[model samples]
Target: MPQQYGTGMSHTYSTTSSSQPPMGTGTGKKHDGYPTYRPIGTGGTVGTIPNSMTESSKPVYKPTVTYAQTSRATVEPKSSSSPGQMYSKTRSGPSSKPTHTGDCKTPGGLPGLSKTQQILLSDTRADAINNVLTKNEHFKFSFGNKRTGGPGKGGEVVPANRKTFPALTGTGLGMAVVFLGPCGFNTPHVHPRAAELGIVTEGTIVSSMIPENGVNVHNADGTAPREILNTLHQYDATIFFQGAVHSQFNPGCGNATFVAALSAEDFGTGQVAQELFGARNNAAVADVFGDAIDGADVDKLRGAISNNVALGVEQCLKRCNINKRK
Candidate 1:
């Protein structure tokens, strides 16, 4: 920052170098074409920098920027398991935080994984999380410090959640990639914690979203579900709001792929069809159809909920010359 000369109470005058002379005359002498300063206050200092002073001459200024200062006490992980792995924690996570194992990995707060698979998920997630932190080398592969989802049947979904990559926690961003085979479909689902910005990276697919109406869509309120649809070709993009019911279907014969950047690290995915049919109360679930199907046949439909990546559009399947799978 440029040095300041003012000390007392005075009008805050900017040290603006002007081509014109000061409003009043200046006490300092003008050398070359440099503007001069005049004493016109009692609170702040007033000084003029010469337009022609060399770095070694009259005034000197140093950089006054302080970067990346936070109020959190940073704690480093020192363990025999994950040596040299480091993380900066703000300690702002939920008060019921899980025990921090070695390698900067935690076992709680992962929306989906923590529910039923806690015992099974802890070790698997720890390994994956550690690999991301330790194997991310500086160049032999970082050739640049910068180098570089979920899907259905022929489709694949890779969700980059906190469990798989603990670095993503509290980052306000997450990712999931989906691949769809010819006539493949990504079933209707809602991400309770995240809004998604999706980009089509390959082939073509139809997408849709239905957000809650007005203040919020509630099951108790019997809010009607309204869906809006759009088609995305290669390189096209679209967005889905949090809690919106969304779906994607590949219309072309070739494989389709899309990447979704979500707004929350633990964004949870609930496939609508699976959740609706997954209820143990068969009568209650079957009641949703209300006479649409015979009661005797309802039992057969119990486990028939289509997979997230199931076949879509038999016409498209025929056009693509892909055999239907049972």
Candidate 2:
């Protein structure tokens, strides 16, 4: 009969009778007169066998195993549908150019302007030109039909003030056309609000300005700041920095004419001598001029300054024995 040895009935083997020797006993004996079975090449039975054995028993067998050499490769999980892909963060070339923020459409490539500011600027510019045009005929008559008037005709100024000129309101700019008489002057004064720029159209003039500090100090070479002397002639131009004492004189025997412009619409003038000497009382005046200038002399000087007449002209005429020419 055949007998079971392990948990599964999948495999079976036959041995000898119950009185015969067990499997792997190796006693060189047969069991129940049956031949003993041993594993090939090992010279031994795999396990002990039951005494009751039969010719139907069968032995379990194992399959041979083999190993082959292979190379290892790393792989990353796929972020997209495609697998084993690669990427880089490095740039291919230099950085791009910077962007411009200024308003290129505006004149002078100026910065961005508010809508109100742009509208006001356009309106004022047209208005300023129109105002001059409206007064063109009147000025033409005053100028004797010439672009520039001649001497003996004297000079007149047309000022653009916010109160008098509606075009100047909120414009932040003002202008004046001046025609000076022979030996005339604009006087020593300062603009309270803005600097002044003037261009001479005809004749010659001596432009003088003492800084507000009143120091006529000079360089080691005797040259002063800006220049030692500011003398302008026809087609010449000059700028008087803000708040500095300045004046223009018609040094030529003929009349002089110039065009002047200010940055502010409401630019006002304060004559230096009148503002200092004439506006203050006697004691305050004495403190500034010192006791050397008599109180009576101070009063006389104040009156002279208020009058704005050029000094030393009469003396020059008398010394030169030449008759005065108006």
Candidate 3:
């Protein structure tokens, strides 16, 4: 006899005497030595094994497993008064936000974390929204020093990353704080990876940009084929797309400051004015700009721009009709 275990029931097969002889034998005599087998039920029965197969050649019956049984094998057994009784099982999952249940670990479940990692791992949507009052990176890290090259130019940048401002972890963003003294300028520069959105917090500035598409492809007047220029004042905002050559100048007598947010954490800079005009010698500068610009003009421009003082402030002030200090 053999037994088979199915999803919800069991099946059995056994040898029994047959009144009729085997299929080819015409003699209608009972055969009990090698008995034939039949399923007990007409409906809802497992398929019978073929009679042609020898008893030794047939595959053995095996039990079919149910979902509940499979689940129980791996899961910890629940204790109860009766062994047959089961309690509902549950498993803990990763947190919806960064959280530590008194134990420091990343969302990735690694331990032995740094203070910066710990803070970042505890961030949540609710906590991030309240950053203006708590752990505000700009106010805490950048606002106080107020370093400047001169009256017209200096900028403090918060390159928010896991290392710099851990609270911004998982958020791909950063900021630049530009402060211009009356008649100060932030020289022509490009953020290779970031597009910038800036708001003027005080005074006025002339914002200018030559798009990357127009860098080598320029008009005959030595300007980019396409350019953007705007006069921004207190509370005025502007956007400079990624990889564009741009500059800002304070045209007002009063000091100016603007806060800019960048699209990426590591926004790199290339200052075009310094690289092109502030070279140590004339030959390098002329080679950089090519034969289109005269060698004499390159030297002349280099002398004018090499100073720590910003070059465009006086011209900006004059055009805006703001006085340039004598």
lDDT of each: 0.53, 0.48, 0.51
Answer with 1 or 2, whichever has the higher TM-score.
1
- lDDT for 128 in candidate 2 is 34
TM-score of model number 3: 0.45
TM-score of each: 0.45, 0.40, 0.45
Worst 10 contiguous positions by lDDT, candidate 1:
138-147
Residues 1-326 of candidate 3 have per-residue lDDT tens digits of: 11224432322221222111222222223234435523222212233446787876653322222222222223333333332232222323454564544323243455676535554544574543353224454325544354434322232333444455555555678777777655555656788888999999888777877676635544666653455778888899999999887777666656678888888766777767556664445664443232221112223334423222233454555555554322
Q: Pick the candidate with the highest TM-score.
A: 1
Model 3 lDDT at residue 133: 23
Q: Write the per-residue lDDT of candidate 1 for residues 156-205, one digit (tens) a residue.
A: 56677765555565457788877676666665679999999999999987
With candidate 2 superimposed using the best TM-score fit, by how many Å does residue 318's alpha carbon deviate from the native?
Answer: 7.4
